[model samples]
Target chain A: MFDLSTPQRQSKKVIALYAFKSLRGFIFFFVFAAFGMRGFLEGLAFTGLVLFVAATSLIGPVIQYLFFKFHIEQDEFILNKGWLFKEKKAVPLERIQSVNLEQNLLQRILKVYSVQIETAGSKEKELEIKALDESAALSLKQALLDISNQREEQEKTEVTEPEKKTVNPTSNEVSSTLLKLSFLDLFKVGMTQNHLRSGGVAIGLVVGSYFKFQDVIKQFFGDYLDGWEWENLMSFASLGMLFSFLLIFLVFSIVVSLITVFSNYYGFKAVVYQSHLELSMGLIKRQEIRVPIEKIQSLEFRTNPLRQWLGYSTAYIYQAQSDANKASKVSIPACKKEHIKILQETAFKDSVVDATIDIPCNGFSYMRLASYIMLATLIPTLVPLAYFGDYNWVVPMLIPAVVIVFWSYMYGSNSGIVTDKGFIGFKKGWLFKSFSISPVFKAQAVEKWDSIFIRRREEMHVKFHTASGSNGLRYFKKDAVNHLLNYINNTVIKSNRNWM
Target chain B: MTNEQILTHSLPDIESFSFEKHPKRFLNKKLIANTLYMIPLAIAVGFLFYNFSEFPWLGWSGLGLWAFILLFSLFVNYKEYFVRGYTLREHDITYRKGWIFHHQITVPFNRIQHTEINHGPIDRLFNLCELEIYTAGGSSSDLSISGLDPKDAQNLKSFVAGKTSTHV
Candidate 1:
């Protein structure tokens, strides 16, 4: 057992990990030294700079590792670090949301794990132990969890009856493996991954790097680039070239998607304890995340047409919003329909299973489509009139107008709302569909909005705000909106359960 | 109650609540604040008019547009003052605002993370305070009730704090 009550530093190997991290920051300096410097004097200066970088990178991590110490005392987890400006943090045990373990390539090579202690507070306020052996990390996680549970029980007893102390039952808590992805399942997930998003990311990376490396390219081949004829090169480009280029991009994106899928979900597994769910995955940068069931504000399931046909979807578990990390939501990729059902049932025990979309916002859809079409038409018509002073450009703009109308129609038709006694769900999207479900009691606020036009049409928009985020129905009948608002409000007021 | 009963039960209608308007002096405060902004804008327009004296039509149109905007804003502020009202219920508080686009938000006391009473320089001069209620749902879901009497703000803050503690 790990003695967590006494202050301790991470494993000695953490110094090397820290050095590597700090050295990564000096990459720009290395690049500049390699390409920007010339002459013996400049070369000597570059050598000095390199020596300075090496010394600082080596010495900084040593100091950081030496100064860092953490221990649990009373009901607080205290951490002390920083060399020049001494810093200390003490987070109450009850406020800790989860204790995750992650192992990147470097850490894996060093045979050490990093522990991330997440609190219900802002992300910056959380704690991280850069390197700890597997057993040490596991024991520390358990110690923190056990103490937090004890603190909660103590608080409950104090609140209910000062004399009646409850015994901790964490030792006998049931743990079950919820889901595990097989090799074939992983392959299917990779094959059905969103290629479009991968393609967009790949293109973005290429464009961004091109701009980043533009100065370096100009320095090396400035004369050659200046003498080149860009107009002549464009004259040689044809429809066939464009088609071939598109095909290449498509193939590249699919490869990237497959690689990402294999690396991220290689050994995906989910395990659920009585109070929290744990997910561990990744081949290169292994990560394990744990979230208390109570803190989960909403659950979202997303799938494309292909994934839906393949009988799997990605589920996102949204907890209380941490100000520092907006993308703190945990996602489980390649969850079959049954898996999603199990997750939903686990997160919200009282929620109805397989609740269909009961309220369709068709009026809202029609209104959105109509307004989009009007805006599209108006923009094309007015822009050409203002710039060209003619209707000639409007002919070519008709193609985009038709595309917009079709997209808007599809989006509108696919959007809907699901309302049950204990749950509220919002479903939307055309090609990439997403459905999010949250308990009614989890709502922090309810908002009703009505523009003059919407009011004239006797329709309104209703939003349900949860701790994680907000979801709502748009362009619903006034009466329905009002009923939902009232229903949610009443449920929230009457329910004794905590939102988080 | 059964789930069916909970669904069918007639709860107090939020629409029927008789919302209370802010103090009449608060309207004067809003007008003064608007004037402070309008004065600088008017001066900028005047500077432009002087600089562009060669085009008499341009200066005249600029001045006309400024006048129209000034009048429009003043009218909107007045209308919005009436439309903006808040209703405190047994379990929740509702605030409605806007003239053209009506927005009403209801935050249950139990869901409130914390309550703060803010008294700015202008608010101090008017003996008014702004009661801000925050939730874990982030800033967008927070509620700020401005132009509240200082004593009333304190009472509401304490009441909300008490409610949040007990409910949780």
Candidate 2:
């Protein structure tokens, strides 16, 4: 649902940069261009691909720069824009939540910023103007803020209009509003990320990048890579095996960890306003998101297995009304490192401890099948070993199988619980970084899932449903789950409170 | 001034909120017809499975699941079929609903941001409408009466939304 308002503008360059960042397909493009061309068919494919990219790249920018136009009338911003179905949005100044400025490196280089005006707080982004005049963006933001302040004053205190202060936004840019983090701050971040999330963030990056680059890798062991070969295949196979063991496997992990370090990079600053908050982040490609104060539904603090080990917890703000589902609208995604503590100290200055119940380690060994997924290697390798009778395929499977068994044993051993006298937490994500935290009052529904198998073992999946989202504790110590559930279910029922 | 006399309108005879009334419809026939048009396609799917699905297990399973699902939906709706009463209190509006799982939701007039009167083809057939009261909380905490006569629904919405004037 779009607001029928004043001005409308054209295509955004930031979106183009984001679309191009899908590095997976870009790797394939190089492969397709380098050697896989089939002369005439190749020429046709290349020509079509070039034309398609050109048209798409041109359409977004053209619509943003030319067709979109917006202007402010007496009390609202009127936006008009359309490529096919002409749409006009009227966003009343009173309904405006936050007016944010977004400029990526490309936008910054081009000396332009896209403006997003959101009101109903349904995670829709509600993009208003792209490639806007920076001065216009500033003035419009100030105008909305000024109107909100006036309305709040009138609505809350029942006061008459006070003389409006002419805000010179250009001159006020230097007031400690900008927060920048440097290399020293990275150390604080490093200290907060325990071995788990760091390893998870690392291994996930490595594995993801390695699989992504599989298309580019032609011959790892020359001819010995697929079938049975001897002669110099042994020499090359040894070399390739060494290369994987040393460089591709080990060094790749380091590279992936480094990439994750940049991906989770946060020079995050929430520019707090009277009624709205503007969030700016990104080290390479900067982005600013604005969330209205009223749209925030519920807030939670969670510690991944890593952060918990490091004695740190992260604060996440769950907002209502995204373009689609409300459960997934996380505006203030986890504050980096000690910033969570700072957030709790400042942003949640008047809050009590959320969950008194200690985190529970749900002892579910079956879940480790994902972490130790190399067990499937035997099936693929066995098929080839039986049909082709080649022992070479079996070696690749053995290496992964060993790693999988080790992974399963380690994950299984680490599964344990530390429940408190009051709240309850369930840990489940992966071996790298599991999420576990729960607040008592927030749990809306408690469900016990028992299939025929689970009931035999006297174990069940306990689901704790908060209004927006629910996390299920799978195969927990049934005695503990049942006991806490009984007490919690009773407490919630006894108290006459508005739940639904 | 009574609470329902939100904004003064020409005084029309005020009717006490009742559980009994000839249901007036709020919805256009086009929407209901479009929704009802899907039944044939569902029958066609069952027919296609019965005739063409080479695998007997697949055909039987598909038809069985559809039958079960259709039956379950009917059961839920049958239990929920309700006619609720709505009235204007001194400072608030009260709506009582629920055939099986009953509820009486109350909304203060001052807290109401807007009011809506909606109807579908089924509602139109029975001369009924769904009257909704909106507030800040996105929760279904707002009062919704599903089976009100069209005129009563309009009057309730107009009255609650502060469009009703006593002068009418």
Candidate 3:
């Protein structure tokens, strides 16, 4: 009963979105053109140019949208577009990894959303319908998933038991909201944030811009500065001025973090459907992301010192499909502690503690790390100290060395753990700690490396590679690496779990 | 149960696993490739030595270091032929290589995204090819076992493909 020949176009709302995006891209050009214009003829020419550019941009999307059409074939989903180029691409339904629906404020207002189709065969989004009616988008996703599921069932040679519940693609079942961040939660996340890091970033930005500002000043007041003796400027570099500058920078960073957190995470909510987890956040854009439960690779529970003290931890669910343009690993930031446990339960569906094998960090490891750090810094500092012929330089060098040593000691003392039952679990982090749990069945590859340096200490570095990404523990005892590698490999070989 | 017995049954030792050595002629192929690469590098070093001949010891030491490195690499290449091997189990494959800094990589068939057979002009002359198995995460193959007879590589590829098709 399914007709495979007909092609369809996206909703007309995409035209406005595309035109708006194109107009936004011209802001820099407009600024530069306005700055360069001085005469009446030039202003007239600029106005004409703006009109011409706007017309061209507007016409492009209209023509492309008219030509763009997608069809659902028997075995593949085919998309054809581009009036001049006439491009056609067909993606096998079996290769389709995920279908994600996203909506911005404009899209929501227009009653349309974008559908991004990701395939495992390529890193990029294989297909994107820029705008579709909300119900249409959901139906498209459901149809694609159902087709894939049908193909999978057909490929299974063995006769298995029938599914307990048949999922209706067009069901009107509503999902329960798991967690939503209130204004107070956002405040906590902002307060418990790393103030020093953002402060350092602000300081770096100022320092970098200082040279450009100096160039501008030289252009304007070069002769004046040359004639004046500028020795007095060094007086402002005193310790008290430095401390106040740092305090101001810290305050500035705190303010920036609060503003950023509030704006980005405004109305943040996580919801659980039958087969997917939807995360909606952002104030201006109102970003919505759908992460399929099956595509999730690992669950990471992260807690910094302040968050630990505040009794809350951030959670991240790393998935297999990377976002179309931004290759960033998406994380659920500032999740409540109870929410973290619920997320783990939903993802793993089993007990967590029983599968853990904790590797205790001992004093010897700390001593080893300290010695390595000292030896690493000693050679670089010696030459500068000797050339300066002053012992004061050595003190400055030792400051960084001591801080590094202390950090190393802290990191070394923190225990590492790995466990495997239904899923593979690993825990790490000293100051900013995290526990990563990935399904054991999805273990793609396991590797062990024993470099000459590690070989001397009778240790090996082991890495566990999953579909999403790889994470590992370094400087473990050689036997431990061997054991971990064997366990993962054996499990992968013997288990009947379907990673796809 | 004794600890030894428990260890023997529970843990699959890397040393105990039987690994198939690559064809011996692969060493000749490696030497030719090395010589082709070293000729230009040696010429560049010689030109540098000629330009800075005023410091004769510098040139001599530079040449000595280059010669030492060339010889050491050749020896290591030869040694790797014996040590570098791959093993195919029921559902997974393992490739081991390197002498000083040893490494072993094991990849399950279900995790393999795809497999590729690659060969160069020299490799064709030697009737050898490389089998590269790629995973989902990255651009690079998870395991690339070079220096295989074309037929053998094809067989392995098909075997892996069959396993992956069934499992994935």
**How well does candidate 1 match the true structure, expressed as C-alpha RMSD?**
3.7
**DockQ, every prediction:** 0.49, 0.04, 0.42
Give the Cα error of residue A406 in candidate 2, in Å.
23
Q: What is chain B's TM-score across the candidates, in the order shown?
A: 0.86, 0.55, 0.83
Scored against the true structure, residue A344 in model 1 reaches a CA lDDT of 84
lDDT of 2 by residue, B1-168 (tens): 333342111221342223333332322332344446547757866886878768777667766776776665555444434333555655455454434433333444544556788877666676667777655434434456666667777877777766322211
Using DockQ as the measure, the top candidate is: 1
Docking class of 2: incorrect
- Please, what is the whole-model Cα lDDT of each candidate in the order they appear? 0.82, 0.52, 0.74
Ranking by DockQ: 1, 3, 2
lDDT per residue, candidate 2, A1-500, as tens digits?
Answer: 12224453433553454344443455567566654664745666778876776565656555544656777788877777766778777777776756667776677776777676766534344645656556666666677666765665465343222342333323323333323445544444444444444556767867799777655554354355556556666767676687776655554544554444444556766655544456677665666766554444444555555555555445565443433444334333335554543433343232334333242433344444433455464676588687987877677767766766666555544443334433444444344544343445344444545544445565655655444455564555556665665455444433332221
Per-residue accuracy of model 1 over A1-500 as CA lDDT, tens digit each = 67888999899999999988888878866776677665644756777878988999999999999999999999899999999999999998888888999999999999999999888856474688999999999999988888786676676677755665645456326888889999888888877887889999988999899888887888889999997797977888999998998999888888888889889988999998877898999999999988888789999999998998988889999998767756559999888777887898789885554667776776445647566767866786678586877777666666666666677677767777888867899988788898999988899999988877667777778788988978876777776877788888889888776568
Each model's TM-score for chain A is 0.91, 0.57, 0.84
lDDT of 1: 0.82
Q: Positional deviation of A436 in candidate 1, in angstroms?
A: 1.0
Residue A67 lDDT (model 2): 57
Tell me which residue pairs clash in candidate 3. none
